[model samples]
Target: MDFLSWYDWITPTNPFASLFFGVIFTVIIGITVWIDTKKLKTTTLAMIVGVFVTIFGVTILNFIGFYN
Candidate 1:
């Protein structure tokens, strides 16, 4: 019950791990943005959103002591 909720709400420990893992995600987003740019598509906004969201989430999770 509570354990499950806690697990769901809490984040993993190790901010460095989060950032390191997040780099992969960020790169993927960058690549997507690049493709979109090549196509002259409107995905740059989405990529930026993703980048910010990922960074915010990771930072909160790692820095808020929720990961512990």
Candidate 2:
């Protein structure tokens, strides 16, 4: 199944959905960054920034009536 359908069991309003996906995304990004650079600091920073930006950006989009 596709990624969208993978999360179908999780209702969008559930806070855990966001937390779970955020951690999952962060871990994925961390692995990719580590494989590419082999640096723990860089990987950590990239994962944190990526997760923050993604969540913040989505929140802003929803605020501006983009998601709904």
Q: What TM-scores do the predictions have? A: 0.49, 0.58
The whole-model lDDT of each prediction reads 0.61, 0.68
Clashes of 1: 0
Q: Tens digit of lDDT per residue, candidate 1, span 31-56?
A: 87777576435456656676677789
Candidate 2 lDDT over residue span 1-68, tens digit each: 22344553454433344545666778888899999999989998998898887688557655776534
- Model 1 steric clash pairs: none
Once model 2 is optimally superposed onto the true structure by TM-score, how far is the C-alpha of residue 39 displaced, in angstroms?
1.1
RMSD of every candidate to native, in Å, equals: 7.3, 5.6
> Which ten-residue region of model 1 has the weakest summed lDDT?
1-10
Best by TM-score: 2
Q: Candidate 2 has which clashing residue pairs, if any?
A: none
